[model samples]
Target: MIDVLAPAEAIHAAPELGAVYLSAFGAPGYDEEPARAEEFATEQIPLHSQRDDFKLVVARDAGKLTGFAYGFTGHRGQWWSDRVAAAVSPELADEWIGGHFEVVELAVVVEAQRQGVGAELMAALMTDLPNRKALLTTFADDRPAPRLYRRMGWKVLVPDLGWDSALYGLNLGVPLGH
Candidate 1:
């Protein structure tokens, strides 16, 4: 089952969350730098959980973590928001970045992929969110992450941001790609 966890609860589950993150994102060079990946997950998960508008959804099966999704409300001064703001036009920045929810991370264990776990985590995290829109970035290559976002109605706001990353956005109240 998937459940929304408060910041404290999420923080307490940081180890499991970090494991899941490492399992999902650790590949190739990451395999050679496991400590770096683990360190990033350790630091980021708890820190993001502390944000006021932070939201985290975790999928558990028989008491084991299977997947997770997390994000926070976007504001002007945020590093990600500022970077995206500079990349997009003023109008688009206002429409998508200003007061939007930034989906910082979403990952599922390899064994849990293709079972709708990611989608469920995403839906649960985004549900009832007060933000009018949401934004996320993912590798621009042929990855399941981008496919899932497209299937869920996210549109490419920036197809390629020069680092093999693409920015995607979704208007909460509208149809996909609108």
Candidate 2:
């Protein structure tokens, strides 16, 4: 089962969850790698989430965390393309992490991969949404993540290698994408 959780509570599992995120993304892709500092990345998440636009969803099965998804509304200095970012983002950039419903993170435990946990988490994402779309990003083909998003009807709008993550849009209240 999956449930939307608060950042405060979600942070409690950070060390464990962080380990997982770091492990998967630590060395993803063949010739590309993140250029940002790990400390900065780690700190930005919990801190950025303090904004009102930030929301996190956690999935647990029998008391064990299987997966989680997180995102916020608008963010400042949109890196990829302000126009494209605004189109797919949950909220305006000035709204910061909490302004929009941009899913910054989503992961299922290694042992739980290939299960329906991820899909369940994503389903939970749209349960209360009023927006027509939402943005989610992940390493381009680093794993099955991008493919899964595509399978769910998410389409890539901004192709940014510098972002090191592929940006996707989900039509929340509309028919699945083509």
Candidate 3:
């Protein structure tokens, strides 16, 4: 089952999460460098955990970490938000950049792919976000991640934001219920 983790717990589990991230993205079809796994787990996750409204969720089966997803509220001055803001129009930046839940990473081990793990992770990640919407960037091709986002009602905000990536947005009307 997928369970949300408090920031402390997520930080504590960063090492294992790094392993899963490495395994998932290092597999064929992802362009990430394998060396980044350690850095992401040790540095990025820990730093991101300090952000406001940060959240992380991990899926475990038979005590093995199968997948995880995490994000935090986006704000001005952040590197990613700034870069995205610069490329997009003032209207898009105004509506979808700051204050949105920025989905930072979602990964599932190769063995867990195509089994609804990604979908479940996303649903749990966005179920009750304080933000009115969420955003992410993924490869601009017909990949599983992009397909899953589109399937879940995320619209394409920018066909090519940069680095061969596409920006996506989801207007989360009322966080599951009023």
| TM-scores, each model vs. reference | 0.91, 0.70, 0.95
Write model 2 residue lDDT over 47-121, tens digit each, in one string: 756854566777777886666777666544554336444544455333322234577677676677788777777
In what order do the candidates fall by TM-score, top score first?
3, 1, 2
What's each prediction's clash count?
0, 12, 0
Tens digits of per-residue lDDT for model 1 on 1-178?
A: 9999888998888888878877887754236256755675678777777775999899999999989999998889888889988877888887787688899989888788889999898878878988889999998887888999998889889888777789999888874433
lDDT of 3 by residue, 49-139 (tens): 9999999999999999999999999999999999999999999999888999999999998899999999899999998889988999998
Q: How does model 2 fare in lDDT?
A: 0.62
Error of 2 at 41 (Å): 9.2
Clashing residue pairs found in predicted model 3: none
By lDDT, the better pick of 1 and 3 is 3
lDDT-based ranking: 3, 1, 2
Assess the local accuracy of residue 116 in candidate 1 as a C-alpha lDDT between 0 and 100.
91
List per-prediction Cα lDDT, in the order shown: 0.84, 0.62, 0.91
Candidate 2: residue 68 Cα off by (Å): 1.2
Tell me the lDDT of model 2 at 164.
Answer: 65
